[model samples]
Target chain A: MRIEAVALRYRYPRAASEALRGASVGAASGSSLAILGPNGCGKSTLLGALIGNIAPSSGRVLLGGRDLATLAPRAAARLVAFLPQFERMSFALSALEYALLGRAPRLGAFAQPAKADEDAAYRALEGAGAADLAGRRVNELSGGELQLVRIARCLAQDTPAIVMDEPTSMLDPAHARMVADAVRALAASGRTLVFSTHDAAFAAYAADEVSLMRGGSDQFRGPVAEALEAGRLASCFGVPFGAASAPSAFFR
Target chain B: MPRSPDDLRARSGKVLLLALAGLALLAFCLLAGRYPRPGLLDPRLLSSDATARAIVLGSRLPRLAAALLLGAVMAAAGNAFQMVFGNPLVEPGFLGVSQGAALGAALALVAGARSEFVVAGSAFGFALAALAAAALLARAFPFGGWVLRLVLAGFAVSAFMSAGLALVKYAADPLRELPDIVYWTMGSLSGASWRRLGFAAIPALGSTAFLVAYRWRVTALSADEAVVRSLGARPALSRALVLAIASAGVAAAVAMAGAVSWIGLVVPHAARLMFGADARRSMPASIALGAYFAALCDTIARAAFPGELPLGAVTAVIGSAAFVALLARGKVPVAR
Candidate 1:
């Protein structure tokens, strides 16, 4: 499936400036796309818009050539699975129970998860390497482990497209690499993967294409190599360009 | 990794023990009252003696049934409220729906509408008003989150209703209406009849059924909205619908039983302790445990003294002690 945004704009309530202004991008089928942006540059807002969590003030979002706003919640869910950056839970649900929630869209109204749903959830957990933690309470999981379980929940939805906002923002280097590898494997399995990241190394390793956002607008969109160029990276982050030190800062 | 036969037997025995305990409590509820009745083992008196039959089936049985139904409804509603709000501290009364019902009932009584229908009508109206206020606040302040908005709206509406109730009490004829209002506010099952039982039973059972059916989905509300939505559920709409149903059930029970406190707040916590917070298990366990607790409390209230004490008084005394004990034992964590 493909998703396209045209001239998108969004402003949070009571905020002085719009979070997103005329941002546009597209995700090709069965590919990985990374969104890179400085703090407060609308990366999260863009992810929200793509998943219909936030309504754009202007323009339209298209999924598989159909307008996103016109699609029913169930239909939209079947096509797109979204994992937000961080979610704090009030209840202490087991990790398996939390992951099984991903099968909700597939079940009928008022239906509990069947054997097939359980199978899907198990596969998702396995895919995200969270199978061993299934019985543990979500609150007990480490930051990286929780992110994997959250992704497993998205995987359980069995959607063709997955969108995540900084999926590895809180992970250590080893776990970050694991997450990046998982994203690459998901993209390889004919699923469209779209994620936002601040770590350039993860983006270099996983993203087929990269889109840079600055001041709530798309600064550039191109192949990973082109987008990661020293000059382009400096412009996107509003920092001094230094090619020699940039790669090591992310890689190490 | 296979379970041993003894372990399996022990598990089965534990289940049986719980079932027997539930049945014994129910039987004790039926037998303990102002008038003596034949024991559960002897069924002959129910068929032979008129007063025995009247006391057992007409009054005590219906009262027992109402207690059980209301208990289950309140507990289930409390569980739903806590889950949807993503706050374990929440209960059915958090959104002022109970107070709204109370305000409506008080207004009806003050206006001399003493019929059951009038009381229920006022209750339903004010319950809806409370729900609408919470929903509107949620929409108006999108950033405050549903729980925050609901709590704020509840506090405001509850304060308003409390003041209104005070006004009605002051304006009432102290000799006549004041006693009636005061008695109703304290809550009782003394007026329990088949009709009253029917009023509380239908809605209470209906709401419980709805919550049980959606128990799994309700658990998902603790996750991020985008994830829940991707799973084919509309988190906001589901939360609102569940809240409304749960509130309606509580309102119905309040209309019948007159603001019986503690069950809606405490029973869910008790169930969580025993059942480990899986709504599938917790919901049913809550229903059974709540019924047991309420019936047992009512039995104590009726038989503890020469005259029946108010149901609310009994519940408050017992509930506060249990809550404190649970806290002291570190069974229930302090709210963060």
Candidate 2:
């Protein structure tokens, strides 16, 4: 499914300024879009708008040419999957069990997941390259292992598009490379993918296109190579950038 | 790691074993009473001895059924409560359901209402009202997350209900009403009759069925709020619905048993220990195990000595010890 945020504007409850001021971005199916920005650049807010979690004060989000606000939650979820930056698990659930939760939108209110749902969860684990972790308790997994399992959960959702907030943040380079590989694989699977990241090198390696943001507005949107140019990076982040300091880019 | 198929098979087998064990315990409880010489009554006695038949059919059967229902409902509801609130310490009565029921029963008694139906009915009504008040109070609080606000609201509601109960006790006539109120607080199943069991069974059993049928949804609610929403569930709406259903079942059980303790607070923990924490397995396990624990405890409460003991006291003594043992064994996976 193609998703588009057409000039979204939003404000927090007691805040003096809008968090999202006419920020817009879009991603077509079978492509990946990386949102790059400095701190407080409204990337997360824009992602929230795309997923229909936060209502925009004005403008709108569109999913495949249909107004996102018109769809019910289940219908919307069926069209798009989402992964937040952080999630807390209250109990010790096996990886397979946690992934099975993604089948919820397809089941009835009182229905249990059938064999097909279990198969989907297993396939999702394999897709995320964490199939070996299926029976392990999610609470006991290391950070990178947990992130892969979480990505597997998003895959188990089986939606046409997936959105993630900071999918590779807070990880060492090795773990970050693993997540970047997962992202590349997901993009290769012909699904619409959107993710936010502060690592320009990682973004350039994994994303087909990049959307740069500063002060709650899109400053630039183009092919990753053009968006990552030193002048553009310096302007977007309000810092000097030398081509030599662009950092070690992860493998494609 | 074992595959998903093996995990499913193992969990199912464990649940089936628990159900069978529960059935065996029920049979033993039915036969082991003070009547027929303080031990397991020979199964052949029902055909030959008339007094044994009356004791088994007239008294023990209904009481045993009430105890089983009380256990199953409280344990299942307790599991739901813990999952929905995202707090391991939460039990069915944490939201003032027990205190509200106690206050309702005390007020009915002080109002000169003598019938068991009237007293239990009053309790049932107040228990639901207490849940509503807590929810409303939680919504009204501007600070804290949903779980924190609800917990705080429950604490305040319970304190107020306790104060109300104390005032009711102070105003009662010391001799006639005081002892009855005191006895009610300790909880007992001696009043289990066929009619009373029928009255409490409908709501309690219905609620338990819903929780078991919707077990995975309960597990989903146990995740972070943002995760639940991303999964296409309205966390606030779903949480409210689960809490209401679980609280209603708990209120019904409390009305029937008069503030039975420990079963609701501890049985779910045991179920999670025996089975994994997935509600798919632990929920049914909790129901079966709860019935067994309650029946076994009640059998001891009624048959261990000359005079009947309070069911609440017996369960507290046993449940606490089991909790300690579980802790000593380690691997609880409880979030502190």
Candidate 3:
């Protein structure tokens, strides 16, 4: 599915300033787009808009050519899956059970997941290299391992497009590289991917195109090579962006 | 908790066996009560003796039915509440449902409505009202997260209803209404009649079936909002569905058994320990196990003493002790 956010404008209720003011970006079918921004640049909010969680104050989003507003919530979910920043849950569920929950969109209200669903969930876990974690409680997993489980969950959703917010923020370099490889595999399989990150190296490794957001708007949208130039990167974050400023291979 | 398919199958087998064992216990309790001698009845006497037939058919049957229904209702309701709220500490009681029912029944009795139908109906009505009030108050707080807002609202409503119950008790005629209200709060099955059992069955059994039917999707409610959205389910709507169903079951149970505690909070966790945390297994596990536990406690309450003991007191003592033993064993998901 080709996801297009056409001039999205959103303001959190009673906030002093708008979180998104006419931000717009688009990803072609099976393409990966990297949303690069500093903290509070409305990247999460923009992702929220794409997933239909936050209604745009003006403008709109679309999947392929159909307006997102017209798609029922479950129908939209069948086409697009979303992963959020890490959060904890009080209840304990195994990784396989958690991943199989993604199939909920496909089942009828009274139907339980069958063997095929469980097989699909296991396939997704293996795809993300999390098969060994299938029986492990999600709450007991390390942050990086949990990220793999979350990716597996999205894979199980079987959507054409998947959006992830800061998927590598809690990972070590090795795990981050693993995620980059998985993201590449997902894109190579013809799934559209969009993710927000402050890590320029990870973004460069994973995304084909870049959308640099600043002040709640898309400051630049094009090839990552051009949009991630030192001058523009510095301007967005108010920090130096030379080779030394980039995330090091050893550590950030 | 079962991890593999084989283990899961084994756990299901174990659950089925436990259910059968519970049925046997119910039969034993049917013949064993404070029937002058406080012992099991002769099997042949049931068919030949009038007194044995009356005690077995009229008294033990209704009490056994009441125990089974109330126990299964509260524990399964608790399982749903824990999943929907994503907190092990939460149960139907945490939502003010019990307090609301107590207050409603107390007020009805104070107004000279002695009929079981009136008491149960009034209790069910007020229980729904309390849940509605909690939801409304939570919605009013638009800034905080939904889970936090719901917990805060529930706490406030529970306190308010409890105070209302106290006031009703204080204003009642000290000789008659006060004792009755106190007895109801202590939770006894002495009033178990066929009509009362019938009154509690619709909501109690119906809600349990609804929750068990939708058990898989209910896991989404325990997840973060993003997961719920990703799964294409409405978090608010699903959460409300779970809360409403569980609350109605608990309201009916409380109305019938009056303030029976601990089963809702403890048995679900025990089910999670044995069957894993997924509601699919744990919910049915809760139904079977809770019925056994409550029936056992009721048997002890009726037969272990010269006079009838309060069911609530016996359950709390045994329930907390069993929970402590489980915690000490170091195998279950206790609070997480």
Q: Higher-DockQ candidate among 1 and 2?
A: 2
On a 0 to 100 scale, what is the lDDT of residue A32 in model 3? Answer: 91
Worst 10 residues of 1 chain A by lDDT: A243-252
- Clashing pairs for predicted structure model 3, backbone only: none
Model 2 stretches astray by more than 4 angstroms: A243-249, B1-13
DockQ metric for all predictions: 0.47, 0.62, 0.57
Q: In angstroms, give how far residue B137 of model 3 lies from its true place.
A: 2.0
Query: Model 2: per-residue lDDT, tens digit, B1-336?
Result: 235587678867887887788778888998997776878899899999999999899999999999999999999999999888887777899989999999999999899898999999999999998999999999999887888999999999999999999999999999999888888888899989999999999999999999999898999899888778888889999999998999999999999999888887789888887788899888988998898899999999998998989998999999889877877786455665
Off by over 4 Å in 3: A245-252, B1-5, B325-336
Best by lDDT: 2
- Taking chain B only, the TM-score of every model is 0.91, 0.96, 0.94
lDDT of 3 at A27: 91
Report lDDT (Cα) of residue B98, candidate 2.
92
